[model samples]
Target chain A: MTDQASDLQEAGGQPESQDNETAATEPGVPEAAEKSGVSGKEVVLARDVSKVYGSGHAATTALRDASVHLHEGEFMALLGPSGSGKTTLLSILGALLTPTSGEVTVSGTDITELTSKEQSRFRANRIGFVFQNFNLVPFLTATENMLIAAQFASVPKRQAQDRADRLLEELGLSELRNQIPSQLSGGERQRVAIGRALMNDPDAILVDEPTANLDTKLGTAVVELLAREIKGRGKAGIMVTHDVRMVEFTDRTVEILDGVVCC
Target chain B: MGLAWKEMLRRRGRFLSVGIALLLINLLVLFLVSQLTGLDEGQTGAIRALDSDLLTFDAGVDQSLFRSSIPVSDVQEAEAVEGVAAVGPVGILFGTGRTEAEVVPDELFDMSVFGYEPGSPGEPAGLVEGRLPRAGETGVGTIDETVKSDGVEIGDTVYFAESDRPIEIVGFVDDSTFQLQPTLWVELGTWQELLAVVRPERVGSEPTANVLAVDVDPGADPSEVAREVDSSLPGTETVTVDDAIAALPGLSEQRQTFFTIIGMTYLAAAIVVTLFFALITLEKAEQIGILKAIGARTRSLAGSVLVQGLLLAIPAFLGAAAVTVLIGATLPPELPFAIDTGAWLTVGIVTVSVAVIGALLSFRRISRIDPANAIGGTGD
Candidate 1:
């Protein structure tokens, strides 16, 4: 773990946030999102986020006091273990969920506070999501997968077609446009998923452990492609992963332990 | 196609299952309703063709066919009543043998034979065959005419099934039936020799006759005149034209039973369509969520789901109509199926109404799907 962390530290292509650097230099304390410079351009901010399910004492806390800020053009990795609120934070970041308390800001808009319709429109225009399970609709072809994402973005079919073509081409998959998800290889399918996430040129991309199913070589390549291509577009990306190897490709590393950040 | 429609259609086996069920329900409803409506029209037409107004019968005699008879003098007595116009005496009987084409009429039906006085108000309007019967000749019914079915032509001699008397075919009219039997009209005087002889206690007096049909004056109240006529007769009942028609042997009861059957079938079809749509909505929860997540309006989604339910139902309705036409074509006239504009319109309205009701179930389920669950979050 230590060796991989060091190699990842050099190869990860990102520095810790200014506050994270300070905290790392000193070590040992629980810090909130405000204290973590973590390239804080404020693309995404969760102020005192809390999500509780059920009622009474039996109620479970999925996220408590979870706060974050994703910056513009920065590739940030959310490092954690299994059941450590990785997916929960991504949902909040993508505007797919509402926090029980506090607010989430995406693209200068407070998403959790938006009406259901406004929230939908906001997510459609500004947020992109990647799931660890490669959640491309199985019935759709690779090109159609991109087209469908563009559909939710409310782009006209003609323009969506053009964007879908460009994205598939950029993903090195122009030739596999007609293949369904099941027909594509593991890495090819993941590339298709990335193209789908990038189809509408959203302001930010949220990936929930994208490489959890891939081997080290493939996962490394996925991380490299997302970080380089995503940042090149002047868009921020927040990836939730337990894999230390992802640190090489990211612009910053955020260590989250037990719903709080550890610097 | 929308994704919801595409997904439902893509599953061929399931589509076929739902479609087959709908087809059966539709067919049942269509055939049953058509039969019910047809009977109503047929009974009315049959009554209309007789061309009579008010009728006087024995007070509280069992029913019209088995009604107690009154004297022929009762006609003059009714005609004397204020507001009553021409009054005529009529009698009915049946005999069957061979038709003009040599087909055994008895094997086909128990043909009815009605006898009416000359210039009687109760005469059938017209005929399909030759002419009205003369005093010396026999007259045949209209339903068996060659113009109707085969070569049972006017002026052709037809023999009674068991009686030795043979009659010449006469002109036939549409919808002339009594006691569910198609009528062959003969002159009233000829019928007396065949059906009655002098009674011992009432020797030399004219034998009992069926009833007196009273036609009201142009601006007169027939029911009131009929009541006056009843007061004049010692033991008799007065009924309006409609009441007399209803009293016909078995027409009303038969029609009522058929209508009940049809109503039940329509309800059954509605239930089946509703059940299928409910199951379909349940299966599509995840897809519904995806739509919700992507900002599909609840109304639009519900409308599309309803549109699918309608799509499934419309074809079944068409199938039902087709089957109704096929079945209506084969029934014998004795069955009195009145397939007409009213019946068809009723069926069309029912089909749409039931389909709309069936689709409402899916609408509720779609509205409740959370957009968050569609994104594969914590919700199931």
Candidate 2:
């Protein structure tokens, strides 16, 4: 067993021998491929990535020669305290921020070399992001928010509407599809945001504290729903969180501290 | 465009407030423009309608019609100048007139007395109701149709307040207003007699004329003839008819004042629009970051803002134009309000262009939004 998986099981107070069986049969958790019969392919590869802000005396290093990889059909949890570079690594992986020095390959494209404009296009087409605050546009209804992703991808209006409707229905938000974010509850708004993230059928999803605004019961339920969607569609996901209790819902957990990966 | 429409719909109150302010501003500007146009036409329409190309007056008079005087000898000299086709002496005097009817009191109305030679080009055209006055006709005059409003008609005798001399109304002319006053056309001999009586000091001097309306020969440049006439007749100045109208006392100054007010109103409207959109963009900064992080291009977002501005501004401009036209049409003739399609078109174009420019100014903020802020980090 990998040291990270062993640590995750220990943190959850589960025996190491039962980790594989528990992950495979949890209904929403995907089987840990290293132990299960299935072998997953790597979809996101980052090598020796480093990000530095400012310069000279004012320079602050956010990431220092850190590396990570995400595999298809795997739901990984990124655990770290404040200012530990977890968000920076996730941003670089999602193409929202550029690494000062590194190589990042996602879905067969070296995103680290892409220009700013090209990176935006790459994010639109290949990666989806769910912000911690459930950043659905306040002016748009849930359906419109979901369709915005497809619209940016240049999907035909009719087809985009159809996909948006299907995603909303699958997320059990059909009744609230026409409600603006202000009118929806915290849990409902997060679901709409997740629906928006999946509208373009992106190759990978980057979630930043998706349950930060919810209660414990609701947060666990939301994360379980995300894990089920990620594994069922065979899409890679890297969820950043500080909640160790939520690690049980993920296949692997990696910890970071002080600009360096510890596990 | 879709996003823009939805945002406007969602925040209709805010957008509507801007639209209402713009509408009121545009309405005020259009009304002022109409009034200025009407006042200009009222003050100079008769002079502009003259068939002659230029007018000659005494030089060093600062282009004031009341201050200018040309001797009959100067008129002959102007006629002899090269390129001069025709020359006719005209005299203008402002005086009060009273009808003989008992119902009309003395000092009843103001009138501009135009004295011109019989059968001269200086005579008013479109005489709808009377014949031109003849030379040596002591008590006959042609009155404009506007005099009908004062209870005077053909064959009625109106006497000048200064001379108390009776002049019979023999004809009526249409649209012959001068200096915002009704006109009464009289023979040059009678006008000279009346002028001598009104200003007795001029009775012993040689006959003098206020101006000489000069026509240019066919295929001749009026400006060239004007220069030649000015040089030919010493102590006399010549200017094209258009220049003479512009030189009218208080006309240019009034126009400039109105234009400045209108320009400032337009500028103020643009600033209001700019501040409005800037505030809206400032409030939506977080939403903008969210959109950018979701893959929206800066161009697309900026386009949405421009579209919103145009959508708001165009409808407001059209509404203001409609209201101005309605008010102008229903106003009484004495109110001096006139609006034309050309003026409305100019207002519409300028207003929409300003609005679009204002919206574009907010684009700098949109382009600088950091998408990383939409995430949960320290917005680095």
Candidate 3:
């Protein structure tokens, strides 16, 4: 067993042996492949990524030599405490922030080297994000929020509408399609956010603290649905969370501490 | 675009305040435009409507029609000049007139007594009611239609307060006004008699008129004819009707002042719209961050902001125009309130352009919004 896995088991207070129920597979290996004793394609790869925020004496390091990856259908939990640089690494992988030094390959593109506009387009087409606070546009309806993702990728309106309708139905939010964020409950709003993320049928998903505003029961239900989506759709996903309970929903857990990553 | 419109519709209450402010600004601008038009018409309508192509004033009087005193013989000399077709003397006397019956006591109507040849260059062009005064007629005058609002009618005798003289309203003329007062067109004899009674000192050794109206021959240049007339009559300044109107005392200054105020108003509107959107952009910084994170382009976001500003400004301008028209219809006619559609259209175009510019001014803040804020440090 890897020392990181042993450390995770100890920190999680689990048994010495990881069973099928607590499947802790390789960082970039599909869960189904592990179960079937086969291998799958690696979908997300980050190599020696580091992020520095400033310059000279005022410079501060947010991430250091972080390396992680996710395979097709793999759901990974990025477990970390406050200021552990997990979000920073996620941001870099999402093409939202440029790392001081790193190679981030999502799907097939080296996003770190792409221009700002190209990165934005790449994010819209290949990567989906679910913000912690469910940042749906307050004035837009649930369906519109979902359609906005497609709009960013310049999808045809008819096609986008069709996808939005399917997403809303799949997320169990069909009846509340026309309801804005204010009218939606906490869980419903999160579901809308998820619908938005999946609208583009992206290659990967990045979820940030999906249950920070929900109760324990609702939080678990949300995480379970997220894992099911990633697995059933054969897409890679990374969920950044500090909750140890939430880690069980993921196929693997990558711990981050003091700007360092242990996968 | 749809998102911006949806936000505006859903949060209409929040936008209504700024909408109202823009509406009030439009109203003020339109009203000022109308007032400016009315004032121009009231001050220069009589001169503008004259049948002559030019008017000759005493050079020493600085283009003041009432202050100018030209000898009657100057008309003959102006008519004798090359390219001159006809010339006539025009006298003016400012006074208040009331009906003999005194139906509305103390509510005197302001009137300017204009004396000219009945069928000559200075005659009122539009005689809407009754017939013109005869060449030698006295104690008979054609009054402006505006006096009808104050109960004056044909055959009614109007008593001039300054001279205590009575003149019969033989006809009514349309759009004849001078210095915001309705005009009474009468024969030269009648005007001279009133002028003599009001200011005997003005009755010099020879008959005189306030100014000489000169008609240019067909195919002749009015300016050239004016220069000839000015040279012939040594102490006189001859100008085309347009130049004469432009030289009206304080007219250009008044228009300049009004335009300056209107310009400042447009500036204020731009600033208000810009500041309002800036604050709103700040308030929605989180939403902007999320949009950026979702791959929304900065140009698209800026376009949405511009669309929102237009959505507010357009309706506001339309509402203001409608209200301005309604108010124009209800205002007292004597107050000189007139609506000019061309002016309103100009204002509308300027207003929309200003609103668009204001919307663009807030784009820097929008472009600066960091998409990383969507995740924030808490997620780490």
Candidate 4:
């Protein structure tokens, strides 16, 4: 834990994104050529994806013939009411559920027909996630919790450590690296979750209400960080959130009601 | 996956509880398997020590020679069978033996002496430490394994029943126990002399032997050879190796009891493992959704839990092994416990299998995790 990391700002006393000003630009990098493997052209594309739970009469449709396209280097929000099937759509995008009928491609490859191992690889390699509860593993140090996720992705130990360290510093959490999730406040833990999602330099970030637990002031700070850091890294970020206030930093907004995309 | 492992570790109490339960269960299974293996080894050793293709006794004789004897002439009759290559007389007698020169109790041990030909049929299979005796001297042999445990050795001398002269210490053999009491070995002539004072009339009228040990032609049907020998001597029993070893009285019951106990203990362990992991899964329902939302595959989640199960099982198995070794080492000399290699392998495999099956409870949780729950799993 160090002084610079304990605070959220960089050592140079500049906005975190300003540190990348000198970074060499990558041209001719096809979205494919981009270092992050997240689908650069359309990170997520759902064509008429639908989900229905239960059976006839009792069956409830969670997602309709819904369609949406997401691309790299964008910050978008999936906004809707509690029962509007927004979360269901997120699950479908995450590949946790097989929509009753639809074609879904993530990172340019279809997910519907991928084998179990491939699905696992897709999750491990291309995707990063931030849950609303800031699901920091309670038993391990913040570092250990982040490393554990890295392990599933089969990231080499040394690399995982290096990535975790760099990300922790960028997020201004270096001093808290050894603290357990239980010891950190809601905002700090959420920031830790964001760091974990970004540790592998994933192609896309799927944040499920990244600031649902924080106060209005902290919630705004969290979303601003996501927009500046996530977009700066040239990765797509599709966040599903109920908080309209957090939607201010987004470049685009898509709303869902009765399982249909409205705007 | 590494992430799942972190999740498991971050939740220390849950992790330890499940791991400890798995460890204890696996250890129990391995220990029990070892005991059963020991029993199997002991039984096989007994059968092997006989080194005979067939046995013969009077029709009225009981399961083993401790309870019956056959005519010495039965030995000759069996040798006459066409397929019988050689025959030797084995005499079983209940007697009191003394380790040294004392009369009342000084090193005296009760034993059943089985007499055998020095170089041929029914010779013991292996030795613990010493060589079998040559003809010029009578080699009094005892079960070598027992001798080691009891601190009895090749040079120890004992006085046999009905004989004042002490038989010279000669050799040590293993797997000669009947009803768990080790038998000693001596020359037939020497035995006959010892038995003379106990049964004076039979010593002269019959000079009968207890069991007839037969080595048949390798190519001959053993059953036919046994029948041929039985026909030559009416009212006498001719049994093959299968009958003598497999039909040993109460042996089947002993085996059945051994397996039943071991199986029940393993079943109980599996159930305990399942319960422990099930509780962990239930408590971590929200965390599971978090993983699912992150695009973690269901099988990877299941496999990670299984890895935890295996880890816990190994230490438990080690603990059980330690307990088994401790009990075995402290057991008195008379017990016929015979654990061996086959037992240890069986234990490890059974323990691991039990642990994995126990963690299957988590597979159900993995399948049901809806990534949507990651958004607001608590519904708050």
Candidate 5:
């Protein structure tokens, strides 16, 4: 926990922007949450992260000195419209995209310092991802899809099988374990995707537009399910979405416009 | 590899289309190889089956058995060389043979008449049934098994129109064609008599042979002995059995032509594989992007594509091989369709390897897919 506080102190000096001070003083966010760098025993932290695409005058600054964090047992929503840089921020934190400048730490390991291969390994073992389209491998069954997450982390087959079975049962997908993604409904597929994200018991789960393809009723149901699961498992999560209505399901919401972050 | 298998099983129709295309290509290539082998064997089987270590031909004849003329004295000289065991004179002449009664009046078949010493290295080996011609037997001969298609049997008489002579077929030998014609093996005296009758230009000339087949001592190297034979007998050239087969007329050119065609066919198969996998990769770009985003390595993804290619190629090869074997069994004896195991294995290995290489062409496209694309797309 002290290491996380030190990481926050290091982040405090990077590009002293007003958004950073505002994020630090947001209401209902305890002083401990600020000092611990977002929540108790932070699972993911980003300090002044900036992502610039291209080179020279053609460079497009996708994210500008964005500082963010996720703590265990906390579920936060990154609210933004199109081209608002929330997805870029998510991509950087997930290790799918590299920050042009700044640092990111996940599971207490500094990701920005690792090589591309090491980042891949770290992503496989420490973080999980859920996509808007519910990117389940169309050919694999629900159980197999969940097990693939464990496979990416090199988990033993038998252990992965047991974990996948338990996750499917928890998600109420046990009856549809052998069915492929095409056979599953929109909400069902998202549930399978959620199950896969949790299969490795990762430190942080990053989801992108999870309810974009679902109806309002099903979308709310899925978000509630995600909130319950994140709270029950005591894991950190960040869901990126444009729908403001979905914000009520999360413990906190961080809004973004252009390339700037606002609390 | 597991993921590849699952996807292939799920998309049977998609894979089957390419699989059937591969099957047809394999069949065409394999059948062409079989026919080429059959033609090559038809031309060189007699020389390839020789029990002799070396053969000597006239120096200026370019190893042609028809044009080369070796005097009887050359056989003696080769026999006298160091490390020499025995030397036999071989004579070849083309003629037409008509089987005895129970056949049509003029059902003549092309035949190559070979003259060699009975019980010598030049004699036909592997008699399918019956015995070789008895020493000093003037009018008895052994015929190639292909002659049976002309209804000529052992104990039956074959009349040669060119030589104005008739001989008894006392034995049959298999795989003994020469110049794509059935061969008839007879004693040297009988061959000389027939030669004298057909070509009367040499009524009182000395005996001659088209080539001299030599057997070397047990401890002698055939190549060394061949060199010695050439040095000892000036105006004569000696070569091992393999060299003799390679020197056969039109054989090397025919082989090269067929190999070129086969190589082009393999290139076309590789192109088909490359095109199919590239299209499939394009279709699954979103899925691949998602996989990479979640942590799939480039190596594993590329390996999966190769695995899928092999999955299609191996079964296609097996199916083609089965059909080739069936075709070989049903083909007529004179058609010369032989099933060569070495060629079959080589083709199978090359086919699978080419398919894998072709699938690897898609790796570039897959590696360039940005995980960022998977973020907001509807995945439709």
Candidate 6:
């Protein structure tokens, strides 16, 4: 636990915004429940999530009784040491991994009750992912990479193409739309990754170390761009990062120790 | 499918390598099939062209034309049998034809001499330029069109290498090759004279034939009549024309050998394609994980892989087909190589099917990929 705290301290700087503590402790309630004019609403909720890998002697608990919430138009930073189960929790929320015992609701649907195939559909239609390495398919051009997500959503080719063009242009990657991942720089590739994630108009974006591969300047710019996109689109976003400078762009930070979230 | 196509286009070098490999394999298969067809035709074309319904040989000779000896008495007995429409004594002997105009080696112009009575069903039909040998004619014969390629034509004199007896070419017939050799239709007496000189001891006191071509009555079953003829004649066996062709020396064995080679080629091609797809699937593991992570269905990912395979296979098949047609068209007529369209169509379908089956080997890998790994920076 001490090592976990030190790891968090090393990754995150001082809280810079007045809303950080409130956002961290009390996630925004859904607009329908609030009965107020606030447009933001809770997009994701995970209750008492626990994940145990393997069985018997080989059993390893990756997440233990962790609960979290993400709201629309808010950026949450997940900070933890290596192997602190921050990724495990994100995977569960994204419906990429099934929890041993938990209820995860995204948008308005309880995803934990869905079948594997339905979960896959939920992930494709409602969740977007940004990986640390900018895992863009190396063989596809930037536009194609973005269109692939739309394709999975069964969007018509013409519509998908239009959406892809709009996203690329929005990401300031219009000039490099024809370039493959290998032809793009680190920042450009990460932007393409973001565009791909947003192509499906997912309810929430799950980002895992989006700036780990970029230099300080590029990394900061990339995070700022992500923050602007989330706020501009009013989509809920959770970014997992080990770099401290990236915390400035997020609305709140939740640190994980061992496998539980820390206040 | 668009993603699949774009991937292929982006990695043209890898796909092209597989495509070229497939092309070479298809070409080899097509060539072998064409060669088999041509060789089959050359070996049995004359026998197939015969008008007889059944061919009878001496009993106890296992359907072998070379070993069969039908005595003149057996021929009479077969003709006397019920449902026997007509009987023609046809003798086959291998010999060489030589022209005085050139001193060419006899081996280069070896001919299969088919002896038949005038107006008999065993005689070659479709004379392009000349007529059949006259009855009882001892010094004249008709040669197939192939003889013209060897500088022999109508009215030209050719002598048997053994007897040196001059035979005037009285006619030219089209497509009369036998046992992969040029054929010459001679009067039965002329063939007997040459045979007596070549195998004096084998030609006993009575004249003998290698086979008796029997035409069955139109309404009668040839197999039944063949059985009756075989029973009525004390020392004879009967077979249909097809059976006789299959019984030709070394023909069945050659067909089996060619088929075995073709089967192995198909198996090898399938294995090669499987290996190629497997390697490509391995290389794309991370990309597949990412796609799955982004909500790409397993079906679509697997479909993409299959589409990639087809993109390579279809063009390769077309290229091989074109190349085969080109080669078949340009090859010299003397070579025993014929391209049967039916055989080629079968090969084409099988090639594509095998390619698809090969691509299926990667489906399991694609389906098992964990999408979770894609986000953790650990999939690759």
Q: Across residues B1-380, which tens digit of lDDT does each residue of candidate 3 receive?
A: 88888888888888998999999999999999999999988998789767789999999888999899998977787888999998989998887777864435577878888999877899888889898899998888998899999889999898765565679889998878989999988899989888888878999989999999889999999999889988888999999998999999989998999899999999999988988998899999988888889899999999999999999889999999999999999998988777878989999999999889889988999999889778853544
Q: Among these predicted structures, which one has the highest TM-score?
A: 5
- In the range A150-220, model 6's lDDT, one tens digit per residue, is 88888899989987777776566777889999998777788788888888878898999887776677777
Question: How well is each residue in B1-380 modelled by candidate 5, as lDDT tens digits?
Answer: 78999889999998998998999899999999999989988998677555788999999989988888888767777889999999999888876777743335468788888889886779887689888888899999998889787777899988664565679989999888888988888998898888788756543468987899999999999999999999999899899988988988889999999999999999899999999999999999999988877777877888899899999999999999998898889887878688889999999999999898988899999888887676756621
The order of the candidates by lDDT, greatest first, is 3, 5, 2, 6, 4, 1
Ten consecutive residues with minimal summed lDDT in candidate 4 chain A? A18-27
Model 1, A1-263: lDDT tens per residue?
A: 34332332233232333233343223222222222334345677778887887879998877788777776667889888766666677777777778788788876787877777777777667777666666666667899877866766678989999877777665668878999888877777778777777777777888777777777877776777677555545467898888887887787787766666655
Off by over 4 Å in 4: A1-56, A59-74, A93-127, A139-163, A178-180, A199-204, A252-255, A260-263, B1-50, B98-108, B123-175, B199-204, B217-228, B330-332, B360-365
Per-residue alpha-carbon lDDT of model 2 for B1-380, expressed as tens digits? Answer: 79999999999999999999999999999999999888887788667645578988789998777777887656677778999988888887887777854435544788888888776657667688979798667679998787787778999998765676789999988667787777888888878878877766655568887888898899999999999998888778889888999998899999999999999999999999999999999998988888888888889999999999899899999999989988988997776666757877898899999899999999999999988777774422
Q: What share of the true interface contacts does each candidate keep?
A: 0.18, 0.61, 0.79, 0.53, 0.61, 0.74
Model 5 TM-score on chain A: 0.84
Q: How many clashes show up per model?
A: 10, 1, 0, 13, 0, 2
Report the C-alpha displacement of residue A226, candidate 6, in angstroms: 0.9
Clashing pairs in 1: A11-A248, A12-A247, A12-A248, A17-A38, B38-B338, B96-B161, B127-B172, B128-B172, B130-B154, B146-B150
Which scores better on lDDT, 4 or 6?
Answer: 6
Q: List the residue pairs that clash in candidate 2.
A: B130-B171
Provide the TM-score for each candidate, comma-separated.
0.75, 0.88, 0.89, 0.80, 0.90, 0.89
Q: Write the per-residue lDDT of candidate 4 for residues B1-380, one digit (tens) a residue.
A: 55446655656676677666655655555555555555554554544576889888777765565545677766776787899998987776666666666577655666667667666676667766666655534545544455455556667776776467676656677766554555666667666766675556556567777778889998998889989988988877888877876667776777788678878877888887888778777887787767665656677778878887776777777766776678778866555554576667777788788888888767987787665567645542
Which ten contiguous residues of candidate 2 chain B have the minimum total lDDT? B99-108
Candidate numbers sorted by DockQ from highest down: 3, 6, 2, 4, 5, 1
Pairs of residues clashing in candidate 6: A11-A244, B59-B236
Winner on lDDT (3 vs 5): 3
Interface RMSD score of each model: 4.2, 2.5, 1.5, 3.2, 2.7, 2.7
